[model samples]
Target: MRKLFDDHKTDLLVFGGLILAYFLTRLPRLDLIPIFTDEAIYLRWSQIMAYDASLRYLPLVDGKPPLFMWATSIVLKLFPSLDPLLSLRLTSVGGGLFSMAGIIFTSYVFFRNKRISLLAALLYLVVPFTFFYDRFGLADSLLAAFGVWSLGLGALLVQSIRLDVALILGTAIGLGLLTKTPALFFLVTLPLQLLLFNFKTSGWKIRLVKLFLLFLLVVIISQAIFSILRLFPLFHMISQKNLEFIVTPAEFLARPFEFFFNNLKTLLTWEVGYLTAPVALTIAFAFLRGQAVKQNLILAAIFLIHLLYMSTFNKSIFPRFLLTFTPGLLVLAAVGLDQMSTRLRPSLLVLVFVLVLALPVYTDFKLLTDPPTAPIPDGDSKQYINAWPAGYGVKEIRQFLARESSQYPKVTIGTEGTFGLMPYALQLYQKDYPNVEIKDYWPLGETVPAALLEASANHPTYFIIYQRPDVPPNWKLRLVASFQQGRSNDYLRLYQILPED
Candidate 1:
């Protein structure tokens, strides 16, 4: 071990092991799970891009970035004869790999010890939450990759202070913004930190003012070009995805302290994923005391600010949002481990490290094997359901719809759930029949179209109504397929409105 450390190859071995573990744990049964509704939405948008070379509008379904869609589209283009759920999600795998790389690169920045950096990379790579989310066809993993890379590069820029380094940092941040809007935290934080650092030294006098002006000019120019290319509409849109809910200054002023407190509660106790108490505490201790811990601490602060913003409007503040701080967390954890080893026997240090990391791994493994049963006990049940929709039978419903749609092209579907799944179902099932057409009542607003309803009644088309039976219904619609999901049953009844009625 001492020789391995001396040679600086220990970190490489650890980083390689982490990459291996990530693939082993996440790659298997990738195709086994059902295509989630959100994944389906991304796939559908990707299909749109496959047809049109230029995007017509902001493909921001509920304010999500179009990068995921672009990713899916590229995958489909590369592998035309691939499964939508399985092939498309490889992009996320790519993102996860890049993020692991970021972890190693960032750790190498502060420690300059290859072994320590590799260990940090390994810890993040094997982290169950990281692996689980990394495999999913969501935007978080990709955003996380860009965010971490930006941080690592930003650190380099601070150390080297080269114009080329600035350009690289700007590009990484631009990509991150293209991935998710919240990533702007990093873009904004860098200059603010520089200002703060200078202010602390110069007391906000002549030197600080000059530095601030130069920093502001550089930031404005970089962001102006990045925003125009990525977001296009400037303040109107945010990289084709956005925070759907707008915030006002009044809202921020209304509860300044509450925002921080609420985010604190969520960050510590969020259970949709792993929140290993022991590891968290260890990392916290390192952040408070370790060398260069101030930067990591500030990153955590920025992440907390983002969490607070999400919590204010009751936005989904999943722990995945905290992925931006992952590199910092890993570094802090390494510092803590290094401290432990220094203070105690090597054997004791090993025992404590294993225990801290192992508990979360065990719990997350259970979640991987059996998701529904492994939800955070105190949090609401729906939270887990939203996180992993493979637990839901979205795949089964898609297959069923496909097999039935072959016989009739004009079948209409109605459901209370997000209606974005139908077009994706068509994309998935279009393997055999490439020219299949599905005319479904997907957009809820379209369901109430008077002219379309009248034409449907005259033509005598089938209505697939997925609604609760207890609710009041129209007399003309007839019951057909009733699917039960857990305690709730969705009635996919066939309804034919009578011409006279």
Candidate 2:
């Protein structure tokens, strides 16, 4: 043990610093940002599943796989006293750490260079796209972690034909699939490993047969684990959700070239370019210089396969959906940086690295400190707030409800949306307050619902309007508070309904 520690002391120190940096960025004030609509749904589902075993299938009913919610339910069950939002976000933090470790491992596997490995891991830690999603309670982070580890282990299996590595890789792929549907793309790209296989040895035919059997075994294991998801009656909903976005086989056959070029343009220019500009620039440079051609080509093939599938699918796209490809991009970028460093002096290389990474690090810092007002162009920080019923006024509303509950026998509160971030946000926090009855009123343009009107006549009723500036003229109400994102109204007008004589 002493000999091992002495031999790898430098590696240990580097990893320790990386881990410290990861937590420093991820752990502080996790609950400070308002809960996103998706976060609210997932956390609420976990809360339901923690107390009731039968409700484990609840997430599947909403066309989602149950692994993340199931995992979060276990955490919540163990630490019931902890805040649900914090505990749920901690699960994502674990996934983010795993993802960082996987980037380091995958970079070393492909390039066999310590500088590239450390640089890749550092890039993963600081990038705005990874940093923002890592803090939120989402399955994409976990899926990325599993996907990267599976790619690394799969590469090793192809090189050594080892059964143990095959088993670990199979388990990683299975877990990735269970986490999200995108994991199947990793499986689709597995044949690219043939490039890494050595053909110089005699009896290459026999080796190919063995490799085929091992690959078959891995697929069987992954499918067997995936079959567990079929136990739920709503398992079919997964296919339904997939069909909602992607074209069916018949539809694709008819319009084989439909939306192909446009989707590719959008993905390359906006999604990948905006979120990972430094990495994108490095990849372009590496391709032009013709360094690590074979490995770069293999990584490119995998990324292209995943991108083609995503782009062909006809639906609205999100940046988080591109997360599974991020580790591969970072690895390519690290290789590019390492290749560039070989031609430069040590001082010049350090300066170049600092300049390359400065923008992403600054973006991450601003996202953490002042997220609502951050200048990020394409991430959850900017998009989620403007698009969804985020919990901007949730903390204040919860406090007001707590105070008002003590004054009135029962305080009825109405929110704009029913199942999204609006009601779910209050529902997660106000689960203990039975006297605080929260209801949802939908269709923003419609007049106030009769239920709210009746509630206002008897008790201290309050309406939390998220989208509209105008209120019904008949209701005697006073605006208590307003929450805005920058100058735009994210949430508005916590109204206290006045009593009528």
Candidate 3:
């Protein structure tokens, strides 16, 4: 172990610097992106799991695996002083750091080139894709990290044909499966590692048999780990929930091109915008490196196959789903960058590299300072910044309620929706104020809930609405505060339900 450490001592030191860079991108103003519906839901689950032992499986109620929440729960426990939302965001930061390291190791392992590896990590550091996602509380970044690790370890297993490597690879995939259902594709793609196998070597027959055995061990280990979810009957909800986001096999066969055409168009827009069109264009230069064509083919497949498959059947697709393996595209682009560094004239190369790096760096700046106008797709603004689902007013609402509770012995709050931003986000901050009582209502009718009216008799009762188009006249609501969710005209309005005269 000491010898191995000595051999890679420089690499280890460089990686420490890279990890620091990652946190610099992640840790500042972690809540800059307002807690959206999903973050609210996931972080709320993490908060619940940390407080209630029996509810460790709470996310399973929504068809999500418990690993990201479980991990976030640990963060919440350790950093009790930290904002629970910020603490939970650390989970994605850690995952991006892990995935950055995986990019370095996998690039180096595949091509035996330290320059290519360093470039890969550097690209990951600056790319808008990682920059935007890594700093948020989401499971996609963690799943991407596990997917990248599995890629690196799968390569090692193929080259060494070792049971130990397969064991490690399977463990990574198992953890991924425990994070998101999309990880099952990792299990499906593991066999493609044979593309890296050395058929040119002598004693090929025995090596083939050993490879088969090790591969089978990998399947056994990953599937066995996945079966842990089966302990709870809600595990079946995972498959059921999947039907909501993807075309079933039967649906796919029936209308393969129906959604595929438009979905593919949207995905390409997301990829080009986030990937930075020039950086993606440079991936073509990877072919110039003159390594085994099969090696490049497999690496490209890491991103390509997943994109195509998701485009084919994804009913509820988002740019984040592509994050799992799109860093592989960066590994390929890193090779291209490395090759240009060697082949181009010194001055010309500098110009090319600077131009290539400019957009992603600028995009990162916009994302950190102001995301609504960032160069990425409008979809981001719709979901996270501008839409009803956005949490533009959530923090202010919490602070408002916190103050109201202090001024009065009892404060009653009503939020628009039951499950996500309204109730869950508000509930997360409800811990300290014993005087505050928050209840949720949905499907607003012509009149307010009688409970809100009853609570109003003695307590200051306030209701929060997010983009409720036709707030009922019978609500007798007076606007206490209103903030535009984003550049969009939609406002998150706080109204105190006044009792009738």
Candidate 4:
């Protein structure tokens, strides 16, 4: 062990620094940002699954795979005393760190250059897209990590034909599939390995047979593990829910040209432009210079396959969907930098790195200081703060409920959403408080629910409004507390219902 450490001391030191940097950026005030609706739903599912095994298939009802929630449940069970939401976020942190390591390994495997590998890892460490999602309590980070490692191990397996690498790759692929639906993209991109394979080698026939067997082994193992999702009846819901996002074959065939053009426009302008500007520039430069053209083309093919798959299927493209290819982009960018450094001056490479990273680093700084009001586009901080039914005012509202619970025998709170962040956020916090009864009132614009009005006639009630400012004028409620984003008039209001005689 000492000898090993001594031999790779530089690598070890660099990794240590990267890990520290990751934690510094991810761990401090981990729960500072409000719990997003998805985060709340995921955490609540884990909470349910931790104690009850029968409900392990709960996330499938919402078209979600169960790996992230399962992992979260295990963490919560192990550390029962820790903050539940924070524990869930920590799982994503683990996934992010593993993803960084995977980036390094993948870069080394492909380019066989330590400088490019290290640079890829560094870029992943600091990129705002990566940094923000790594801290978030979502399955995207985990999916990205597993997808990256699977691709890396798949590359190594193709070269070495090692059983151990095959097993690891299969496991990573399985986990990725179980994490989210986008893992299918990794499988879709796997065929591009044919471009990387050498056909002119000695004993090519035998080598191809062995490679085929290994590939089959990986698919079988991954499928076997994935079959666990089918244990519940709601497993079919995954396919059903997925259909809502994607156009049917008949619909696509009828409007193929229109569908293709629209998807292409959205893909280039929004998905690719927003998340991978630097990587795209690097690819363009590589193509222009005709450097590593074959490898770059292969990478581009993989990226485009994933992009086109997402564009075709994703009705509403979210920023998080792009995470599956983030490591690939970073690796390509690293290759671009390394190649450019050889052609141009080394200082020019540094300048390119600085320019590429400037905006992302600044955005990350904003997220760290004031996440709720960060000026990041399509970020959880800005997007979910006051607009979404997240846990922005949840902590404050919970405090109010706790205080009121002591004064009254029973306190009831009605939230704007049924199962989303509002009521679920309060539900997560108020689990121990048996005196508090949390209810949901859906369809935000409608008048106060008759049930809530009837409940208010019996006792004092509170209504939490995140969707709109005004409630019915006849409801006779006073605004007790309001939580606002920094310097923003938009806020979540909690109103206390006045008792009616």
Candidate 3 lDDT over residue span 245-357, tens digit each: 99988998888767877888888898878889889888889897686577688888867778888888888888888888887888998988988988899999989989999
Per-model lDDT: 0.60, 0.80, 0.86, 0.78
Task: Kindly indicate the candidate among 3 and 4 with the higher lDDT.
Answer: 3
Q: After superposing candidate 4, which stretches have Cα over 4 Å from the reference?
A: 257-262, 270-280, 286-291, 346-349, 372-375, 379-382, 444-451, 485-490
Which is better, 2 or 4, measured by TM-score?
2
Q: Per-residue lDDT for 1-501 in model 2, tens only?
A: 999999999999999999999999999888877777788999999999998998888988878888888889989989988888888898899899999999899878777889989988888887877887788899999999998898888888888888898888888888888898878877778889888888999988888899889999889888877878899888999989878778888988899868788877766765554355766777665576776687788877888887887788666666677788888888888887877888789999888888888888787777777776655554454556654355676777788888888787888998877777778878887755669999887765445567777888888888887766677667667888987743355555688766655
Query: Which lDDT tens digits does candidate 1 get at residues 53-154?
Result: 666234543455566677878888888777767756788888888888887787676557666676676667656556667777788888888877776766
RMSD of each: 5.4, 2.2, 1.5, 2.4
**Which portions of model 1 miss their true places by more than 4 Å?**
1-15, 60-63, 192-225, 229-235, 239-243, 254-260, 271-273, 287-296, 305-316, 376-391, 405-419, 427-437, 440-472, 475-501
Query: Which ranges of candidate 2 are over 4 A from the true structure?
Result: 253-258, 273-275, 288-291, 379-382, 444-447, 468-476, 486-489, 498-501
Best by TM-score: 3
Q: List the residue pairs that clash in candidate 3.
A: none
| Model 3 residue 27 distance off true place after TM-score fit, in angstroms | 1.3
